[model samples]
Target: MTAVLDEAIKKASITWVSVGDGPAYALWCMPVESSLIVVTGPGEQHAPGLTSAPTATVRLRGDHGGLIVTAEATVTRLDHAGEEWAEIAPQLAGKRLNASGPAAEVVARWAATGCAIVRLTPAEGTPVTAPHLPDDSAAAPPRETPARVETRRPFRLHRVRPPRT
Candidate 1:
């Protein structure tokens, strides 16, 4: 299933839902080994609160269909040096937009701003489930700001029916 998920996320953004961060999708995600890796912060396109999450739901959507992978997220400081990070650094850095020079150099500059690389693995002891989240692919993440606090609106359904022959 991870193999199937890998191919999907590689083709489309993952709808990531984590506590406090609401939900956000990313176009800058990569499947590293058996796990999926994503980098997000002020300059990136995904949720920054992923760093504070221990568990989150990751959804992959594409022409091949979609799958929901409940994952345990581990936050790693990309600025640090480690053997595991070393091996994947190139792959991560190469995905950085407009990155110049080698991966090592790009990583240094990328991580210099307190950014992080998040490694997500399928949650242990939990079987992969059917899509547990409704499709929000067309909606933006909800802002929790005070100005938006009074904007709660109930959901309404717009039913469509084909004309009877």
Candidate 2:
């Protein structure tokens, strides 16, 4: 792995991943060995098509919170019963923030819910890095969701009264 890629992966707790032609989804990840591990499912972070897609584009942000590197990565879904999962699941659980339960319970829940644990391995090629980065900000409109902000009149501290009637 290139030094820049290694540094970026090691430092980033989250990354934006695009599978196939789908919209990029921000996902929390843990760097395990030379690959990044991401969990996605019903209750976990949504990464549409990541488990099924063979390849994905991963963008990592630098300390300044700007895109630093973009690379093509091969996606591999780890089997829940496999040895790799046995070793990595606990680590991922520990890294997971605000988990609903203990690490073991979290892992069990993931297994029971058929959550996907995917490893993103950077493909062999020159990643798009600084100085060669795209000029466009690549911003896109937010996706439609059921969530909405409630609109209400502002709270007032004082109100006009009829001259102490």
Model 1, 1-165: lDDT tens digits are: 455455554564444545444555444667765566777665555575677677666655556544444444444444446676667767888876776778888777656766667776655544344465445544665666555556577775976578899
TM-score of each: 0.60, 0.91
RMSDs, each prediction? 9.4, 3.6
Off by over 4 Å in 1: 1-17, 64-79, 100-102, 125-165
Per-residue lDDT tens digits for candidate 2, residues 71-107, read: 9999999999999999999999998899988999999
Colliding pairs, model 2: none
Provide the clash count, candidate 1.
0
Model 2 alpha-carbon drift over 4 Å, by segment: 157-165
Best by lDDT: 2
| Local distance difference test values of all predictions, in order | 0.59, 0.91
